[model samples]
Structures are given as structure tokens and as C-alpha cells.
Target: MIKAKSRPFLKHGKPERRPDLMNLTDSRIIGVYGAQWRGYLQYYLLAHNVWQLNRLQWVMLTSMLKTLAGKHRSTVSKMARTYQATTDTRHGPRVCFQTSVERAGRPPLVTRFGGIPLKRQKKAVLDDRPPAPMAGRRHSSELLARLHCGRCELCEQRADVHVHHISKLADLAASGQPQPQWTQLMVRKRRKTLIVCPTCHDHIHHQQPANTPT
Candidate 1:
């Protein structure tokens, strides 16, 4: 049997200092299915900074400890979509993670499911009649902060303000000039955007411009 020093990730231990947050001193010998898996997880998490993960993301990752690759992909897809998370494939197969919101002051977290068992991804079918180019990229953090202004842009409502991008993503990607930056901070710029409340964002998406509350 291969001996690997796996951290007690699945252990539900109380915080040593506060009611929330685990102690960094906590480490225990746990049985990994094999040495290869143990090494893969350690490298993946360490490279991505596991200490920065939020509660929901950490919970989702721990739940997949013993899952197979196919199940892992399916679960990851569902969870990523639900959480509006980002996905990447740097170390292995594919890892889906979340980004920090500047307004909320939240930390970022990453979850990787790729290993030896991961399968190749399938390609999406292209439409013969593609839609015209529109700026579909997400709004920048700076732009979002400006739009928020402590209230909804359209109705000026104070609750649950959100930013909406006005341009199509394809146009933005095509136009954005590549900038030199750290791998994590790299991004493409969008030309146009709008910041609005949840209601206004939904209205814009539904093509109901007139019904959108001003």
C-alpha cells in the first residue's frame, strides 16, 4: 500500500479561534485511494491557493473527494453553472473555480476534478447563421463599481444592485488588445456595459426594453 500524507479535508472540525474559519495548524493522516490521486490534489490545491476558498466552494470540492471523473465533470458543470463560477484547465483535465467580487470583498476559490480518469471535452455545434457581433463580455470591476454607486442604475433602488454588460462578448474579444499580466489577472476588455438592478438586468435580457423600470 502507498502511504500519502493527505490533509483531513473531509473532516468537519470546529475552528480553534473563532466560531467560523478552520485553524491552519490542523493536519492529519488520511487514507487516499492511491498515491497518484493524493499527489494530484495536493499540487492542484496548493498551486491555486486553497486557503482563499469560500464556504460553498470548499463544501462542493470536499463532496467530490471520492467521485470518478465522469461524475466529477457532471457535478462540476452543474455546480459551476449554479454558482456562476469560472472554469479552467491548467494542471489537468478541467478545474472550475469562483472569482472574487470587489464590491463584496470576497475571496476567490478553485476546485479541480481533472486527473488520470478525466475524459476529453466535447465540442459545441456552430450555427450556420450566426448572430451579428455584439459586445457580450462581462463588465470590468472598475466599471461595475462605478455603475453600482450604492444603488440600482435604472430604478435607483438600493437592494441587490447588479451590473449588466451592454455589448456582445465576441465583439469585445475580437477588439481587445492583449495585455501583459500575471496569468490570473489576464482578461479581455468589453467596449460597452450597463449597471442595473436584478429586475432591470432581467428585463434587458428578455428584450423588454419598455417594461424595464427606469
Candidate 2:
């Protein structure tokens, strides 16, 4: 059933010679295979028939190899031999195919296929979330990654960077009240939150006092 469902990614009686991927780089080709296979396994982690994915594994491995072979104008056996590598997992070292891309200022992205253990994972988290707004989720991820560059937006302080947030943009420019320097900065940047270091954050809070109970 899985094979039938995946027929579009395969060729008739020639799943090992995918000409469709001839234009992609080896890293992209290999990464796509790894991500798809991992996602499928994660989704079916609780199924009793989880071991059945080994069959899909062979199917995808062949297609990934053949796709690379087509790109390099080489034979499947040669491509397999070239990219074959051993990766260590909780289940021990497993043979897989790998591809890499080195960047000038960052670590290389090393992608692999077929190192995952085909074992039952009763406690694995399933990737079965219902669709919802992705904007907030994406914003959090971007913000977390931004923390590594820990430079405050105010005072140019590199230590103790933090954020100052307003509930809404309207709060930053309440009807007749004069905008504070912090509010002016947030308005200039057109953001509801301001990134600051420890000292600047204290100053901002001192100026923007909390409202008293009515």
C-alpha cells in the first residue's frame, strides 16, 4: 500500500533511475530523501506495523541513488559507492549515503539518507499537528536564532540583551500622551517590541510605568 501510494516518486519498473532529479545538486537530492523518510517514520511511530517502513526504505534508497547517478551521468553502483558512509545512531553505526555543502563563514551542511533504525519507537513524538496559523510559530523560531547575535538594539550594549514589548501598536502612541524616547525608537523601527540590554531595559520600564488599578 505504501509502495502504491509512492508511485508518483517512482518510475514504472525503473524506480532506480529517476531522471526528474537530474538538475538538483546532490545535497538537495539527498536532503529531500532524508527529510521525507524521517517525517514518514515519525508520523507512523506508534503503528504496530512500523517495521514495514523498511520496504519503503529500499524503494526510496534506490530512487535517491539513481537520481544522483542521473545527475552525474554515472551508474547507480558507482554513485552508491561514492556517497556511501557510516553514521552512528542509537542503534549503532549504519550505512547511509551522504552529501555536503561547505560555506565560507558557517559550518557545512552535511545531509544523509538511510541511517535511521527501523525499530519500534513507542514514545516518539508524532508529526501530526493540525494546520493552524504559522506566523507566530515562524516568528518564535526566527527570534530564537536571532539571540545568538546578542547585540542590544538600544545603547549598543552586547551584554544582557532583552526585549520590551507593548501589547499593541496603539499603546505606543496612546491618544494625547507624548511618546517616550523608547516609544519613539519602537515607532521608528515600526515594531511592537524593543530589544535592549539590561540597563536600557530598566530605563525603559522606569519611564513606561504600569497602570494603577481603577
Candidate 3:
């Protein structure tokens, strides 16, 4: 009797991609592989020989492209040609694969790969705390620290403050109408997200302009 062949992806110690992910969209496939690449990079970011990870990068990139092209029954080079984009980074311009998912009332979530630098940080200090004004913190870190305090930026309340977001600033200007206070704040602040108390958020959503506290 002849033995039945096992699926390659199901074989022991095989380097096959996940069969469960065969039907996911291109963006999602990229996300899965991008997470793998990012996690790998993060774990080895401090290694002295971190630059050598470029070989693994190539392997993973090809694996991702092959998975994607296989799903669509197309060639790897065709898949590369379709989703490839040039992104400018601190290191300079590099070709990356990219995709976006749009929401009805929110800005599109953009995903890309191959832009991260693999340089080991000599002065790297990993801090688990929320952002403080210390040497290693970005300005956005301080913003996150403030968010964790549960203080409303608009009303200065000490209660549950939440993020209020709109699709984009251009969407606001497209209406050509007087914007609500929270919307006005977002425009003035040049951000699509606003931090406000529930009360203020309700006022903004309900458009209670006459008595809105902003």
C-alpha cells in the first residue's frame, strides 16, 4: 500500500507558511509577516551584529511575497510589482511593500514593510514606563503619559477622558460650516484625534453648540 502524502505546510519542522492565512487579503498577509519581521528585529535590535539580519529579512520578504502570490495564483514578481512603494526614511529612500484599509469615519490605516533600520543602538536604554521628559522619550511619549492620567484635555476633568477622532481635517473644511468646539480644537491643534471628557464628547457629538462647554 502507498502512504498518503502530508501537506507541506503541515509537515514536521517544515518552514511552510500558515495554511489558515491563505485566504486573507494582501494587507493582512503583509501584517502577519510584518509582525514577524518587526518582532524579530526588536528582539535582536541590540545585538552587535544586527546588520546580518538582512539575510533573514530577504528570506521572510520572499516567503511573504510567495504566500501572497500563491493566494492570488500569480507570479512573485507580479505581486512585488503590484504592492511595492518607495518610502523616505532617515536612512534615505527605500522600496517597501504597502497597503491601506479605510474606515467609514476614520483615516485609513496604512501598513508597510522594509523601512526600519537594523542599526544597533549603542546608547539604547529600554524603558517600560510611560513617556517622561527624560533623554530617551519622544514628544509623543509625553502625550501618552498625559493620556494615561485620565484627565480631559478640554475640560481639565479628572474623570474618564477618551479619544474623539474624525476622518481628516480636509473633511472638516469640505463642509464649509462653523465647526463644533471639539472639531475646532482638533483643527487648531492640527490633529485628527481629540482628548475630552465624556460630557464634552457628548456635547461635540450632539452638536450642542449653544451650551457646549468645549
Candidate 4:
């Protein structure tokens, strides 16, 4: 079973230190092994400075070397923690490695079952639909004709309020549910009722008992 080591504690048991040199050096040795296997050690050593690399950079370099050698490469994360001891830091550097091989000629085009060719599909035309009217939806306009916001129980800012419904219009329409008449009655009866915002409306529904009778 794999186990995570506790990071070394600094003053007040805080762990904040760079990775040790042994880990970085091991990664370099693995990188050299990969380079030798790839038959490009001389070229790699001449072109790149492997000795000056950090843990993350070393992992990336080693992974690249393995790829060039046509061998299965270790994951960057695994390479980063290869020589990690119990006193090593947990929050080490993250590395991702990628490689590309040159293709000499055109590759075969094979289609899988149920796959559509890209060129056969037509581009969608713009709908050009007019914007929906918001005259009755405005908070000030809805409150000017109504008495309550229908969400919060507090009575303040009636003019700057909105008429909120307990059930959403889409949900009611989809499920064929009847609109609650108490919402309408509350709006008409109280002249200075609660004026809740959208956030409060959502919060009330979220916090309310889920199984309570509508």
C-alpha cells in the first residue's frame, strides 16, 4: 500500500521548504538512463543543462527522454516523488509532459460506427428572435401595482420591490401545476408588505422543508 509522508515542519510546525537535492539528483540519473536508452545521450547532454533542473523540470526532462527512447515513461508526478522520504514536503511542484512524433505520409481515414462526417453538417442560421418585453417584470414597476414581494416577511422598500412566485413559471408549466392563489391575494391585500430580492427568494425555497405541503 502506498502511504503519504508528513511534510517537514518549520517554526510552529509549518512546512514551507524547497525540495531536497537528492530527489532532484535521482531524477537526473533517471533522465540520463532514458537518454542513453534513446541513443541520444551525447546530443541531449550537449543541448540541455540537466544538472541545473528543479524537481518538476527534471521529471519533465526524464519523461521526454523516455518518450524519445520509445519506452513507457513514468508519470511526471511519480517522477517528482520517486526519491521522496518521510521528511519530504507534500506540496511539491507539479509537472506535465507531452511529446509529438513526425508523420512521414498521410494517415488512413477510418470512421467509427455512428460517427458523422464534419463537412456534411450545415451551419445553423441566426434565429433573429426579438427580445422579450420586460415592462411587467421590472422590480419597481411590479411593486408599484402590487402590495407584497411574496418572498420575505419583512415590510420595507415597497416601491423598490418585486412580485416573486413560490413556484417557477417553467416548472408549473411543465408539470401542469396550479398557481397558488395566496401569492396573488397577498399582493392585493397588504399595501406595505415584504419586498424581497431574488437572492432572498431562492434562499427561502432552499432553506424551507422539502416535504412541506405546497
Candidate 5:
């Protein structure tokens, strides 16, 4: 009334404010949505054996999703719950995860520190003693005495000049052939010839054709 000079036909003033009532409901939806999506992603990666991403990668991805959604706490809790549920079902009872030795009744056969078995030590001690000085022709003494280092007649080697049988005794016995007196003569006469380096002995046996006459 008092000269309200008709407010000069004001065009657009500030629009009226409207509160977003959907925010609360939208937060829950986002929580559930994030949980399902992240769970599926984790499961798929595990199934296909893709282990390239570390924990930090996963955290970064979830953090980004939560920031974009604008409801970080709710989404993280939902994702955690989903992860727990999936792990429990897919991986079996957590308590069952254990080392192989724990499952077996005996102590681990191997140890971090190298330790020889008692049986092996006993065998080694026995081996150190001379081979009962095999009687006749002083074969053991002759082997210990003569036989200077030289290239093996069969396989060339100057080291490890140990005794080697040209034909295995076991193989001869198994062949069902009667041992002739000449065979014994040959064994006794060739005692000097029997000695060769370990490498040469192995090579001689390896080169022999399997079906050759004994």
C-alpha cells in the first residue's frame, strides 16, 4: 500500500529448495550394489587364476567406487560382508588350512638344516673298513699295491682307478651257464686288468650292447 512501486516485474528469483528424501534409500541401494559387483569381480579373478592385482589394487578400486557413490562407509561394510561369505563357502573351513607335515602323523622327512640319516651314517662307517681282505691271491692287497695311473683300455681315464668287473657276477649267475674252470682262471689272471677309473668303468658298461654274448 505504501508506494509498493510494483517490484519492476522481477524475472527469475532463486528457485524454491527441495530436500532429496531419496538419499537414505539410495545409500542402501549403493551398498548392496557395490557389494554384489565387487564380490563377483573377486570370485571371477580367483576362478580364472589371475593373481596380478595385489591388496592395494583392490583397495584403490573399492575406494574409487565408494567416492563416486558418495557413501563410502556403508559400501565398504557391505563389501566386507560379501567377501567373508564368499570365502567361508568357497574356501571351506578356515581352520582346515594347514601345512602338509601338520596333516601327517610323522615329523617332516626333511629339515631346514641338512642332517644325515642314522642308517646312512652306519653304512658309511661299515664301508670305511677294508672289504674283509678277500682271501686267495691277495687280490685286495694287489689292488691296493700295484696298478699305476693310466688311461683305461676300455674307457680312457687316469683318475679313480677302482676295481670294476668286466662282467657282473650276478648277471653270470642268472644266465644259468655253468662256470668253466677257464672262467675262474681268467678272473684270477685278469685281476690287474679289472682296475679302472670310476668314469671309465661306467662308460664301458654303458657302451656294451645289451644283447651281446656274455
Candidate 6:
């Protein structure tokens, strides 16, 4: 992972095998014309109430749009050089859009990334429920990685493996809250989970007993 202190440049490196992440490859059409594109993007941002994003974020969003629009891969560096994008040194090498020609209108010049809206979880007011049964579930990838040191807990499959949950905290709590989506987990949740491959996880879940294999 590149340090925030170091400026990120366009460079390709060897792909690291991460057992926790599920990668998907697909292509989409991004049809946004010059004037119409800007208008649409601005409207999207305003609709989401997230129009005040920084330059780097805007560049990333614009790049994605442009890429989907069947244009060349435009990047932050290219935008900075060509669009006269400014840089902010207060934190790190973050590109600023305040000085660019694209900086106009109250809704910002970039569109907000589509994301899952989070609902504030309500706390239990009165408690008088039976003790929830211990439900065995998978654990967090980070926790599993730390516990087994990036190796599958079952067969010790080190490469191209997946994170499995031994026991779920939410299941144990039985809070009745809807399980968060994968994107929500990526953004916020960080719980200790199990690590296993697809075959191993299926085997352990079906043939073998849950939380039995140590």
C-alpha cells in the first residue's frame, strides 16, 4: 500500500494475492457528453447532497465517467497537469479543484460516487428477551488474517483463499438489525472472523461441525 505521505503516480506493480477481497471484472458504458455530462454529473451530486468533494475525489469520479464514456484513462496527474489543478499540502499530496476551470456552481463540478445509505441503528429501549443462541458465523478478514497470519484456518491454504466466519457477533447478539451489505462491511465493520477457502468453508459448514475445527 502506498503511504499517504508519498505522492501517488500512475504505475503498475505485481498484483498481491489477498484472501480477504473478492475481485470482480466487468465493463460498463459511461455515456456522458460534454455539456450534458457536466449537467448530469452536477445533478447527480446535488441529488445526493455530496457535491463538495475535493479535487482528487473529483478527478477519480471524472476519470471513471470518462472511462465509462469510452475515453482514454484520465488520471489525477493528467488532470493536474492539463486542467491546472492545484495541490493541497496541509495533509498530503491531494489535488485541489478550486483553481481549475471546472470549479463553478454551488453543486461542485464532480458527481458523487453511488453508495449505500447508512441508517442510524436504534438502541434497544427495554430489554426482556431470552438469551440468543450462539450462532456460528464467519469472522472478519483482517482478524482472521492476523490470527492465522493470512493462512486459511482449516487447510492452511495460503494463496487464493477466502475469509470464513467461525461465529458471527451479530448472530450472537440477535439485535434484529439487518445484516450490513458487503460495501458497508468494507467501509465500517471490522470484526475478527475465520479464514478458509471456498471448498474448506463449504466442507466445514456442511460435512464438519461449525466451530469444531480449531
Cα lDDT, all candidates: 0.34, 0.70, 0.64, 0.31, 0.33, 0.33
Q: Check candidate 1 and list the clashing pairs.
A: 134-168, 135-167, 135-168, 135-169, 136-167, 136-168, 136-169, 137-169
Candidate 3: RMSD to truth: 15.5
Please, what are the lDDT tens digits per residue for candidate 5 over residues 1-214?
1012111111133111111111222222333333432333344342333233233233433432343234323454454343332113233433111111111345532111101111111122122222222122344533443243233433444454665554544443344555443334234343323555777566646644454234
Predicted structure 4: lDDT? 0.31
lDDT of 2 by residue, 1-214 (tens): 6877367466665566555444434666787677777777778777888888887888888888887877666888999999999999998999988976554468877988888877787888766754332122244544553344465767765676787777677665663567777777767645666668899888877777465110
Expressed as tens digits, the lDDT of each residue in 1-214 for candidate 4 is: 0011112212243322222211121222333333322232222233334223233233334433333332213444463344332321234432322222222354432211111111211332334344333122244544442332222333332233444443432333343334343333333332223345555556545643443323
Candidate 2's C-alpha runs over 4 A off are 129-214
lDDT winner: 2
Model 6 lDDT at residue 48: 35
Comparing 2 with 3 on TM-score, the higher-scoring candidate is 2
Highest-scoring model, TM-score: 2
The C-alpha TM-scores of every prediction are 0.21, 0.57, 0.50, 0.16, 0.21, 0.19
* TM-score, predicted candidate 4 vs. hidden true structure: 0.16
What is candidate 5's TM-score against the reference? 0.21
Model 2 residue 41 CA deviation in Å: 1.3
Candidate 6 residue-wise lDDT, 1-214, digit = tens:
1222112211242212112221110011111112222333333342333333233333434443333322223444553344333343434454323211122234423322322121121341333344322111223423432343334545655444666543444442343443333312322334434455677666645543333332
- TM-score pick, better of 3 and 5: 3
TM-score (C-alpha, index-matched) for candidate 2: 0.57
Question: What lDDT tens digits, residue by residue, belong to model 3 across residues 41-133?
Answer: 666677898888776777667767777777666888998998898888778887788887654457776777677887897766544433222
Model 2 clashing residue pairs (backbone):
none
Q: Clashing residue pairs in candidate 4, if any? A: none
lDDT of 6: 0.33
